[model samples]
Target: MAICIPPLDASTESSAERKLHEALRSGLSDDFLVLHSVKWIAKPRGAGPRDGEVDFLICHPKHGLLVVEVKGGGVILDYAMRRFASIDRHGDEHEITNPFEQAMRGKFAILEKLKESPFWQKLGLGRIPLGHAAFFPDVDGVGGLVGPDAPLDIIGGRQDIALISQWVDRAFTYWAGPGGQGALSELGAGGVATVQRILARVSTTRPLVSARLVQEEQTRIELTERQAAILDLLSRQRRVMVAGGAGTGKTLIAREKAARAAEEGLKTLLVCYNRGLADHLREQCEGIEGLDVATFHQLCKRWIDKAKSELGRDLMAEARRDYPGGTEFDHHQPIALAFAIDAFGPNYDAIIVDEAQDFGDEFWLPIEMMLSDHADGLLYVFLDENQNIYGRSAAIPIKGEPMLLDKNCRNTTTIHAAAYRYYRGVRIEAPEITGTKIELLTAPDIDRQARAISALVTRLVAVEGVAPHDIGVLLCDGRARSSFERALAAMTIPKSSRWGHLEGYGQGSITVDSVAKFKGLERAIIILWGLDASDPVVDRETLYVGMSRAKSMLYLCGTVAACGRVLDAGVA
Candidate 1:
């Protein structure tokens, strides 16, 4: 089987080109390298500048190079007027350049481009055989269609499709005389690979993170508009729960609900469990009047501070003394907020919660109490059970069945496939965008992993144009987080590099956080590090949250055995 650049099924509007491409791909031997639709611009010496496309360029070690110009449909040649036309299936005739002339021009243009490369001269490739041909797949026979330039041997018809190899050999022999050039035979596989490298140089520029974010935002807007009907259907209901898998725009819908309530002149509070998510929600609702955004803990702190005098005691001191250091925030905050709200009365006309799955069973009471009218005020909750990393089985207190959002508007198809392995709920239709594959970087230990991550971040920021703030380093194990931080700090930082934790996010630095803490938040690029084959905490739920946090690019870095375990687990 011949190797075809762009493949035979690649998108093309020309049916004739596709037909000839298929013939060349299927009929040629494995030694042949066929490039279809090669665009070039050249200004040969003693000739006007030529800029056009070559329908097909075939290269072989034994036969040298051949440029083929293919014309589909009915071919009409006007010898007297020196004009050419092709009639389509609709019987509409369109004048076109002579295929023979086009083939010759393309052949020379490519030759000229190749000669400009020093490697071409180093290999003495100029002495190799070169030829051109015109193929008309719709024409039955072109044996009698001879002209000064369009010789019978140089023109191919539909009948030649089956004997394409023979036809190509004949054309090469015609250009090389009775005996082929010995130089052609000497251009072996290595020479062919070098030629391909010269013709199609390895060059690429990744889309800037800012630009990609804009494109993704636009797609979300379109998908979100499609979900507007769901919101409209439940507009009259005062209390509703929206359930969805990750990337299903649950947070987007929650934001919209809060904004709508504010638009209606009702004071609204948009709250979530994660501080990162709360910060994001606040940014999204910045200018809206009558709307307030805060993390559940932040909301608790606010009310607790306001009701301190009525309680007649330092609640923070009491909680610190009664509970363990970190337990005080989880155990005493919500209870204190409830008492504060009861004394101060309800603070808002409507309340909205996002990432509701992260809240404890008792957390709902204080959330509901914030509404001015507990029975009639709007209370909207958005939750994804699969993302419940906190191990909370708390269900929303809403009475009716939750509305389901099954279409994922965020994350590329590749990311979705990897993340959905651990998902066990209603099916989520993958996003339409088929992004690049997830990259897995394996290292021997934490130090090497940190170095690899640093190198990757450098390339992404300095070479690929990705913004530092748009990239995140999410640690899978809590213990590895400090090791990575120490490794990064001890290294000689690049002049352009800046690293920070979630606290310094958006401060023009690459943010780092634990996967559990970074839940409900996303970044354009995520580097999930510190997976251990022996670590029990690196389970399905943890992997799902860490991998899905990447909106575009994902890199999994860990020990070889650990990375192997993830792949063996079928998360790829």
Candidate 2:
């Protein structure tokens, strides 16, 4: 049977009350009493003129029950007044609710219901006391809801509310669980009702992190005139394609742009086609804050799933405005895009597709679709056609449309110069470091190269002070298993995986495989052990990708003749 709870805050309510209600929805306290109170005393949403519903309910097992409510003026903010939330229709204007009195009325309604409810007597619910509270402030342009009795004035702000939450949690500990459930149920019931009534009037503003968190330190890397010009316009363009060769700083430039965006009060998203490049970014962006970095594929999965849950779309459709595009965002709008996202679910605020060169062809469509829908969202991208180790023929996602960051920051000047001479048509600017002599090494047979590589790595890590983790070997035919076997037999290396993928963190490595697999990845030293010169360009590309992986060193021990020919023009 339905229980009747009076509409307690009936006196004065409007749309201004939404923020408070929404904030309390999903996280209705973990305490058993708190949870019960919230669920049982929930105010009938949309039953009146208020624009929103209560945040959440907290039914206690004992003590006066708490009806949790949130409140703020039109806005909530950081110390310098960077608005996190506003209480009104726009960022301006305060709501019109007296939170305190409204809370009392809510308490009364719950009491009324408790007295009449057969469920109350059957369950012994009426003995519970009642209490109510309103909380969470509004920031500029952000909002919150309030009961008619809410405190319209701003207090200590967001920090105060955080403290208040602690107090509330502690005070209600008596009703947290099994031992406390029964007593709390009777005592806190009324308090929960009042809070619900007021809470029902609140709404959730945007999260604070997205709006406020920022970094203070900044640094600079000199840019060429062309680089400066392209980057300048790139700062403003949302969707851009950046393509170039070895020293282009395509990666470096992208990082700077993302950092700059964060500084401009916009979120920064950095992505790469390869795990290696992504790792390199993590290493490079170590100190800079506010950059949300990830691989293109990973982000696509996240946004689509998040959006789907929010919209509740169990079925698929074409271009559902709501569905977020996931993993395969190959450019151009496609019917397939809708189906894909319909399954995964939501879109993100912005997107940055890195390493566009290596992503399989025909993947830009969904990306275009998602980036088109969001506000102030980015569609930033970076890549180098010459660096397409995957051999996919997908047209670069952006034409004149992309912003290029193709400056090589990882290589020395000699390496950069050599890359340019050896690899023509590649659009990378050489690093300014003086050249390091390129050498070729080969054994009487395959055995010789392997031993040299293994020894080189051991020496670098043990004597050179590089972490064993910082050295990697690139071998043909997926020789990681072979290496593991030898290492296990010889007891030279331990059998282990990087980052605990077995525990479900990531797909990590224990050995050598295709250079493509390690694209975007880096180690302090790279040892390219096996080589076949059958396809010079292909081998050159693989060598390029591998060489670029090291921040400090590259140890290549392959067919001397083949190596020399590949490096004949120059060394990358």
Candidate 3:
């Protein structure tokens, strides 16, 4: 049986085309390759450019090339008017293009396109035989439909379906003419493979990193506009808590709200739990005056330092004296910030907290106290409970019901499918952007995994034309991140490659970091490494956060057993 490019399916609109496709697939030898619905645009030497489509482009090592046009229903040809039509089962006639002309034009156009390839000249395939034919599965006899261009031998009818190979061979012979057998034989198996490669290269294409990013940004803007309605609805509310899953634009909405508040002459502070996210917010909100961005601990430390410098009060020392048991940042910093807020009084008119689920109950008091008027000051908190990897259970101080963001606008549908398996939350509507599937690359150990990753990175950058900075390598096992980094550093990478953390992401280097550090952030392409099923730290939440970071493409690299465990964990 012949191989089909797209594989014959019921989705084909024309019943006649489907019938012909099946007949060719079953009747042709294994050497033949049938490509259906092949469309192309061509510019002949003296004529203007024209668009053409061949219903079936048949290729064989021994038979050369043939373009076949299939007309399922009754075909009507008017030689005087040079017009053609098709009669349906209901006896209704629909005007149609001349199948013979279309097939011939498609054949020439495809031949011209193939000739443009340097490979054709190198292989000396210019003299290879090429032909065109028309097939009418519903018509009883097309032998009388011969003309100057439509020869009787090149026109097929219902009875010819059983002997499609012989009919095609006859068409080839008619086009090749006498003594053209040498030309047909010239396109040996090797030459035919070269032609296939040329055709495939010309036909297959993918968007580059820049174009994909632009498309994704446009989609994000549209989705953000849809989420803006929620802000408009809550414009008058003093305190609001917005809850959503990852990629729901919580951080984006928070930034917009903070900017608007600052524009109103209100001092606004935008804070999140992740330092990388905080740095990103700071960079994005740089020129906006009266708005400050920081992580919760960073804000606490900044306030304590200011109090000690200007007010002659060492709040950090006092907090250390009072709370001496737990970690300084966790226990003492919030206390110090509360003391500093008391000393300086409310300094901001509004405060926006992103990644609110990462903040503990103790952190909200000082946060609320930062508002000039606690009763009427604006406080918006965005949180996704599922991403509380640090396991903080804070009862947010917002009064009214939290608004729910159900749509995910960040990750593509393919990445969403893998990530949402571990998500335990309200249903999140997947994004409309359907992207490439998650690729799994397995090795036996970290050394082999590093080599595979290096090759993949090179291909993505050198061959696939992806920017180095657009790619990221995230370690699923945070503890093994350094080990993976060392292994990768030992490998021979491209000279253009620069390895750094998420802080240096998109700055002309490929960044590598733990999935936890990259929380609340995303990259266009993500390569997740060090996925060990035996590691206790690599749990469902870790997988969810790591896999969700990819916006366009995702490659999961690990040992076979590790990858198998991940797939078995419902991520398949």
| Structural similarity to truth (TM-score) of each candidate | 0.59, 0.49, 0.61
Please give, for residues 243-309, the per-residue lDDT of candidate 3 as tens digits: 8887888877888778766644467899989888887777667788789999999999899999989
Candidate 3 Cα misplacement greater than 4 A, ranges? 1-220, 224-226, 534-538
In model 2, which regions exceed 4 Å deviation?
1-229, 279-291, 303-337, 340-349, 372-377, 395-407, 426-429, 476-513, 569-572
Pick the winner on TM-score between candidates 2 and 3.
3
Q: What is the C-alpha RMSD of each candidate to the true structure, in Å?
A: 21.7, 17.3, 20.7
**Model 3 TM-score (2 dp):** 0.61
lDDT of 2 by residue, 84-200 (tens): 443555547554445444455656665553443333434444355455555544433212332233323322234433344444554355234436545444444444454333322
Rank candidates by TM-score, best first.
Answer: 3, 1, 2
Compared with the true structure, all predictions reach lDDT values of 0.75, 0.48, 0.78
Sorted by lDDT (best first), the order is 3, 1, 2
| Candidate 3, RMSD to the unseen true structure | 20.7
Error of 1 at 124 (Å): 82
Single out the weakest 10-residue window by summed lDDT for candidate 3: 203-212
* Clash count list over all predictions: 0, 111, 0
